[model samples]
Target: MSNSNPHRFSLESFRRKLASVDALPQLCVLGVIAGVITGCLMTLFRMLLKLGAMFFMPDNDPEAFEQLTPMLRSALPLLAVTLIGGWLALHSGGSRHQIGIAHVIERLTYQQGRFPIRNWISQWWIGLVSVLGGLSAGREGPAIHLGAAASSGLGTALKLPHNSLRVLVACGTAAGISASFNTPLAGVIFAMEVVMMEYTTVGFIPVILASFMGSVISQSVFGFDPPFQKAGVEMDSFIHLPWIAASALLIGLLAGGFVRLARSASRLDILPFALRLGLVGVAVGLTAFWYPEVQGMGYDSMRLTLEGNVAVDVLMAIAIGKLILTAGAVACRVPVSIIGPILVAGGAAGALCGMVGNMLLPGVHTDPALYALIGMAAMMAAVLQAPMAALMALLELTHNPQLMLPSMLAVVVACLTARQLCGCDGFFISVTRYGMHPLQQPLMQALSRISVPAVMERNLTRTRRRLSYEQASALLDANPEWIIIERSSDDKPALAMNAAHLARWLLEHTADDVLIDAEGMFDLLEIPGERLELAPIHLQATLSEAYQCLNENPVDALYVVHGRRPDKPRISGIITRSAIERYYRYEDQSTTKNR
Candidate 1:
């Protein structure tokens, strides 16, 4: 125990450093670590998908579901869902079935980013099966879940503080997006705009580093080529702006309807998992029978749409089919990836609009591909409610800066239409509404950034409920600000007494000859000092957690402790409600001054 103290103290010191708002160097190192971890995992995930495709897909093309016979295409989703449903039924306890970006957000918001190992494992095989089974899903959602779980697992193994763990989760999320899409800047923006839901200098540095590392690692394996071919198509005239805005409005309505459908479907969660997934299989199977282009991620369909090779009617059919099928899959809680399908559908819709425009104005020779690209960005922004991320993804995917102006216009219109006209929050937020809070309050956000140790009062000492006069005197000789009255039994709560109050009581008692001989024992609780009921809090807790603890427990202060044993935990420090308020007040003032 004595030897462990030094090591534990060093670790606690490290945690304290991370609690600071300016721990950029430490966080950047963590970011790099997270990126490398997530990147490697993402590579493995993609490789596995490719390997799976080799066995089932003709020509080893993941998107070659179109080449499969209609009967085979129809059967594939049913077979895949059967396996998935059976697997989920075996593990039908707890939240093991909950997987993907929505799970990531729930963990970050409610659990401080600690991911469960069971769900992480479940996501690997389930995600693989969903895409391989031609379930109108993307690999990106599963990749994000895997990345976040891996990074959070690393932090857990290292026993990092919760506040730092939150940052690491953000790092992993960005790295997942970066590795999956090979878009580092977009990855960082998505992590901030979608997952973390806030941006800060401290967060940006680590997320950026993680995203860069993820992209670098992914590029090394998959090469430096972007996913979509550069269409070399650009908008030639401003006369198309009104048409673009009109298309955005339509896309927004579709996105909002998609969200609404998914939310309404979530209500069916009370049904058996197998029943819901089986229905999803039937819907997807029937759709794939008619339009195999809607199966899988639909990247092949997207490519065709962008090249204007597909007929206008085909584009419209693919768009509507993908949207409804994907939404139905989501409603059935099939764990299908929505991002890839959303992009594919959006591009198709945009291409259909572009074809209509060309027909309407036969004199103009604008390419449908331009509208497809802009539509992809606009739809993504509307569905995710992340305009900056969508724009970044557009810029990176297309490697074109000129489209930024027009894409921005379409994105804003789509986002406004979806949010105002359709009344839909982002998809992830809406789906996980039961377990999520916006956490948008400024004071709460401010408090979450700081760990308890950063604001806790260390000028304190712990003693038993009863102490000899000399022991009490000796304890006060240290000039501690507070005295912790250790509970006599496991069931009783510990308490805190102000040192000044104890000192005054001692002085009065001594003057009255109550303890002149210094032989009597003093019951600290019985003394005339204000005693605050104390709840035990872990040393790694953030100030936000401390604030929550104070609110949830009928206590005025908390005794910070370490170790797993509640009966014999090591009390490290004391934090009063007043102390937390004072710290936040100082921080608020400092921020105001800086502003």
Candidate 2:
């Protein structure tokens, strides 16, 4: 128990300070391995994306790869046809193939840190194809998956212990983010702060190892700096706070709208996933007529926003256009994600707002570049509700102060608005969609339910007096599974008298008072199992879950704590063995009648 205290402390500290490193030194090598795998995977993903681009090129394009000949380009429909092959091959295995972060988390709680290795590759390939086929997706889904998978896979392949595997998975997730974005610190934060949810020494070693390794791998190929560079950000005037706040509010509202729209649009009750995604393709084709910039990754839109290339009229239109398209694409739920599209829309909107500010107040206006940065940040914060991720992204990618202030302000507002209106943080919404709750610290919740503090009984016989003949006789009369002779802090011998042994003793020994006084004298001798130990309840659990905790307990009786603290444990009472039998009987009867 004392040895485990350090692990808990590390996790707690890691959660508080995202920038800190406090994990174990022993796990450092694995973290580096996680980073290398993540970098390799990211590079592979980029190459696959290039391949996808080549496949979709028009016949007339001079830039078309030799691999995709003009004839194949002419028969463009073939590209869409074969893409399904990857998805099918990947998803057709077992139910385990459907595993996501949620499943990983579920395994963490009950299954001693086991994760499925064989199934990860299949889903990984499927995600890659989804993006390759113009599904309006981002790298996040696959990046984290690959990151976790690679680390978890490594642990599994090496035949490490269960706890070690969990640590490896954390390393993988961190490395994944590092490789994907070249944001090493953010990668560490993502793994420790988000995935592992451990802030203590446990996370420190893994997160640092993963982050550093991932950064090294990514830098080896893409260089140590950011891939896409722009001018440094500059601070804006405090007078523009109102404008920034207004923009933030508007982006938040739109973000909420986008979330709802996406969910609703994705609902193809009768159609399959492919069919639904194809429907999104149709929308893209139609929307392309008006705004072809929305066709691909919207790189053009981001560039144009920074350059202030679009007129006020067109900027607003592009914003709305991307918003609708993103919502629709997300609804279809193929390879769709809110990442690239939200940035595009938000940047465009911010640029438009900047233009307006420039027109209205000449000297006090915000910069186009600044607005562009803020827009990107705001939309990302709103849509994804990952303020730290967005802030770090802008900081690492742009390193501009002029943009930073508005970006931070807008991001905070947008994230808050999205949370208030949308009923979930961005990642949580996705987690919830897949039938899992996105808890900040699940150990906190798990500790609340069926914990040793909650289940263990404190009512051991405290009196050290040797049991009198009358008292021993009385204790035997009451049916106890195991009777303790006395309350003891440490190892002390107590009379271990079971009901059967007591009855046998009574039959042989002619104690005349035993038979008469022992009846209905349960409290005369202290029943050790009567006292209850209490722990905090995290609340919102169903009665059925409570029942489960009660049933699995070692003791025949337990308490359903109304609240967490023992002294103030609200309205609940002790649950006796007889009460449990009756409740089960009632439940069974109810089920039978309902059936």
Candidate 3:
């Protein structure tokens, strides 16, 4: 019986339509859905963070960890850490603990963008505990993890094609950043530069739409205020270029040092979860007692730096303190993000440079606000290796075109210094080196553009395991491209013979010799070239999957199948490796012919 529900039917049709080569329309719709979902979830995450802060903070200020008594300030993080550590120790969930940006990248690379629900659940509480307990954690990481997982989970629930799921994950990533920072363009660039690591016009359109919707949803809930608000400032003279270069160098050095520290901490994986977490808690507690600015996302302190309200010595301490504490906390596997703290540290470094400039060279005019803003941009560029996205974010937050030229110089210098002199790629790459697979090459990118249903030969004949000579001849005469011999057991293919080969064999051999018996005909067909061993792949498999199947196995062709369960397998069609090669290599041929 057909399912009578309209929603289910519509979803089913959508899933089916998503298997085509031109799935961009469907993917853009999915992006809208992902954006809405991520935006709502991020708002909720922020609201919950405020609610947690209300419990202990004065006037419900989320950044008021400094106002708590010394004993409470130290004890609260310890208590939060103990609970989080104890819960993880008991539940562990067998690899579900891997929940963050790095985990998202790993799953996209190795698992085809399938994020488990268990990790999503873990991110919710883990992020909450880290921030509520006054640990130097950022909300962006959890927001991204939750958003990406939710969108991927939607695809998984609908049994969508792998390509669609991968796109949905990228959509979610864009939405997450957009919702978190209200910088839609930066979010889109960030998804391409960091998450997808490759971009095409078709891929970018959906991400752009997702980012727009995410920003809209976030603005509706929280007023349309940029995360950072500062008075207008500009680079007054060309004389400031040398100072900007020096500031970028210092910021790059700090970013590289942070990456090194985080990597070192990640190496202590042999330590027990509770012990490592406890040590992180203790470190945060000790640091918080001395430098409360390091607690939470440190946005309040960053705002002070922009206003030039913070003392130079205090700003220097906050910069170094956050760099060390955040790196250590992340290394200990704290379920938090580093992006926010990295920006705060960068701003502090820039503010320090601005103060020293005013002291050393009193004649030259200097804007500490400009330095702080440029520092934030440079640090983000250096740490994430996303210079364009960082620059876009700076423009969006400050909305000052005059800041662009100096910001560009600072961002470029910082990136080169971090990568060339300090010898580090970025924070995420440094700590998650194992998950850092190269982006798909151009040919593989072309192969992944379309799915199996679009390329697989649908003109196929299904027959019994053994076929009579007359039946085989008649089947060949029908001009079916493939003949699938039904298997008695689903674990192995019975036979997948090329009809053209069968026709040639019939022409070469006498009917009397070939048609001695059904068993004899099958035995003769077992000779090389008569048939190929079949690797069963899903009907929704992309050309990339077909190529991978052929490349990884000895099989020459893959049988497109319908059911996922081994017990209920049904042949849908067949695709040969040669067909896949021809599909992509045809472009190469066309270019050659044009030349």
Candidate 4:
């Protein structure tokens, strides 16, 4: 009607066009493909690693491995595995491929959520060979990262909504785990608890589709049988809760110890990555010499335990060995998941604990299988610091209702003890320490984020306190939304005399003992309570964020950092809420344009 050009609509149209890059059907198709590809990769990783171990022994015969010369069998596996691993690692899928779950969390929060293709490839390369070469590591880490990366790539190609993309990433991660362990429900929970940190309907949709699809893919490739899963009793016994809780506490403490030691050892600058990992391989080789059952993810060892052959003391020794091996393995950062090894280690510990508990009780006592089950849940819960994840894992792995109460009971104690003894909660601990906020920030969470530096306004406006009433009114009219105050030159605080308070101060007009400090300056000259100081204490950002402070106490302009003495508050800027709102509007528009 007004002869306005239709070009204005072009901007929104362009955004829409950019966003329509990837189609939904195509994304789903690619997602399924990615899951299948990731599944095959994991299977190959398992197969190759086992082959490496088999070859390292020089004899196809299980009994013949030790009979072969120690120099040939033991030392050779160590040397050959590490060197080849180092070589493969040197050219690993690509340089960026080492990115793990931690990096994923970071990119999601700060960047446009683009995980590098190189990183996923490199992780697969590193994780697969390292595992096959007999490094004391697990495959779940690479599986999760790769799966998530695959989803991210799909989302990019599809140009899906940011939220949808995030969900896809979570789904990919869950699918990897489900496919890896054949724990479907556990996979779902792991995604919700570990990655998404929220179990909302929106998040659940894609994760369910992705996880089930991955499971379907894995089943077709690996077989319908559950990888390490077993069916057990209804555990209808309520009496076991107390004992389970006790065992969980003990296991939690032990798991926590291993986690702390592992992190510390990994930080050792004296030992290089290659040597450290090789040494761990040597350690694992030595472990195999005794508990040959402990080699290769320990699933077979678990099977051996359920069959009731391992001695009590031997089980204990193997359990400790597995913990140390896992710690040493992860210390090298040779690309593996702590989750798998943790499960294995927990099972080993549980078996050991069960055997010992039986021996100590002697007549009417807890079954070894029962204790073993409880131990698994407890340790997993403790080490992972995720009670729900551990519980779900137990349910999926055992399919035993009898173990549920014990598992939940054990999980509670384990999680509590781990948190108290070890400052950080599981998986994302390192990420939290580095300072980027996560979706699920645990207890001491507030300690890290509850600071002036953590949350504050970004942009701000300036003002002076010496202006006349008319000038002040003009400034006021200019900045309707922001409040103005004064600042101090030295170690003094920034003072903000709120416009509302100042107006009332003018009406009240009498100087009294009512002068308050805004920054570090005394506003006692003649202002009333209405003209009280406003501004945050040692804070950063715009007047907008400080408005809450103004509204809460009743005040005006803010005193800010003087140019010379950055720490000291000086009268540098004045702001009214209206001006701040307008600025915020402009800023919001600018940010949208840039995006």
Give lDDT per model, in order.
0.85, 0.56, 0.81, 0.59
lDDT agreement of model 3 with the native: 0.81
TM agreement with the true structure for every prediction: 0.94, 0.65, 0.91, 0.65
- By lDDT, the best candidate is 1
lDDT per residue as tens, model 3, 332-370 = 776668888888989899988988888888999788888
Q: Which stretches in model 3 have alpha-carbon errors above 4 Å?
A: 1-13, 93-96, 430-436, 486-495, 506-513, 518-529, 564-568, 586-595
User: 134 in model 4: Cα distance from truth in Å?
Assistant: 1.9
Alpha-carbon shift of residue 201 in model 2 (angstroms):
4.4
Measured by TM-score, how close is model 4 to the native structure?
0.65
- In terms of TM-score, which candidate is stronger, 2 or 4? 4
Best by TM-score: 1
Candidate 4's C-alpha runs over 4 A off are 1-73, 92-100, 109-112, 159-161, 227-236, 265-267, 433-437, 441-595
Which portions of model 2 miss their true places by more than 4 Å?
1-23, 51-82, 93-119, 158-164, 224-228, 265-267, 310-318, 430-438, 441-595
Model 1 worst lDDT run, 10 consecutive residues: 431-440
Instruction: List, residue by residue over 402-520, the lDDT tens digit for candidate 1.
Output: 78988889999999999999998888885433444455456666777777777788889889987777788888888999998888787888888999998887787663455433556
lDDT of 4 at 477: 55
Instruction: TM-score for candidate 3, please give it.
Output: 0.91
